[model samples]
Target: MGEKLNISPGELRASAHAADTITKDLGRPLSKALEDIAAAADSLRHWSVGPQLKATGEGWGSALGKLRGRVGEHADGLRMVAAGHDVNEENVLNRFKGW
Candidate 1:
């Protein structure tokens, strides 16, 4: 087979850092917005058209919630990728030694 692949975790770690930054940027403001929306929705619940307003607020909150969740997941995924690459290299070395 070709020479054993040489992999470095530096780049992966950098990517993970970038992902984490993005997650914070997206999730922080969104969390604040969600809280505001919840308060607004609660206030609107007493009006005649309150149901519609509440529903709209809920929809917006839901979408933002999903986005924040996804951003968090993405960051987690990147961090996992960064950490996993080192583990993968160790596994390969162990298998190669066994062989």
Candidate 2:
């Protein structure tokens, strides 16, 4: 007779719990520049590319207002993404019991 393999249900339960906790903890939108870009998505899409370019050149006097600038911060985030690093900040309050 061949021996049967058995997997512990407790191990699977623990893994599922850990994944759920991490998902909730990592789901936060925490960048002022990102927030601004998201806020302008609708207006940005409505304007044609050339018009948007010319409007931007016209300075902040245009109806679209000033173009948001977060070049350095956005670049840093891009680098982190390129490096395969998770950009989300870990939730300090969500650590295993006693944390």
Candidate 3:
């Protein structure tokens, strides 16, 4: 098998710092937007036209689903990038001891 490449601690720290910043920036805006959308959806129940109200609710649901997908992608990217730094020779050897 080929030798494993090692990631320096400094590089890991930098990558983690960037991810933290990005998560904070994105999380706040997405949370606020989702809250506003949910409030709007709740208010739709007060509409007089039943079909129109239901349509509005469905639109909100679809929008929320898209927002969730975006958030999930960002979160997964952060995790994957962070995982790249979560390694070392000792840990790798320990994990693959039988190999």
Candidate 4:
């Protein structure tokens, strides 16, 4: 009566790897770009709107940092899930080896 649940460890691992790649590929470059923009804004300190622009860039950087952290956490969670499932499956198979 219960629905069957199917999990593919390989797929989970692949997804985790993709997440990690995304974090690595995008995170550093984007963070660096934001810092550069903030630095550029700082150069305009004499202008009335320069401080606002700098603040905006810093805020975006902070938000991106949080997002990167969250993505990393998700990747870790996915890997853990995949490994756990593999172990569980192995344990189940071992229990039935004598049958």
How high a TM-score does candidate 1 get? 0.55
**Candidate 2 residue spans exceeding 4 A from truth:** 1-5, 30-37, 43-46, 49-99
State the displacement of the C-alpha of residue 75, model 1, in Å, after optimal TM-score superposition. 1.9
Candidate 2 lDDT by residue in tens digits, 1-31: 3335332344444444554554444334323
Report the CA-based lDDT of candidate 4 relative to the real structure: 0.88
Rank the candidate models, highest TM-score first.
4, 1, 3, 2
Candidate 4 local lDDT, 1-99, one digit each (tens): 233556588988999999999889986699689978888898998997889899988898889889988998999999999999989999999999989
Task: Indicate the residue-level lDDT of 49 in model 3.
Answer: 61
State residue 96's C-alpha deviation in candidate 1, in Å: 7.3
Q: For each candidate, what is the lDDT?
A: 0.74, 0.42, 0.62, 0.88
Better of 2 and 4 by TM-score: 4
lDDT of 2 at 35: 45
TM-score of 2: 0.30
Per-prediction CA RMSD (Å) = 5.2, 17.6, 7.4, 2.2
lDDT rank, highest first? 4, 1, 3, 2
TM-score to native of every candidate shown: 0.55, 0.30, 0.42, 0.87
Instruction: Report how far residue 55 has shifted in candidate 2, in Å.
Output: 22
Candidate 3 residue-wise lDDT, 18-52, digit = tens: 65566567666766765665666567656666446
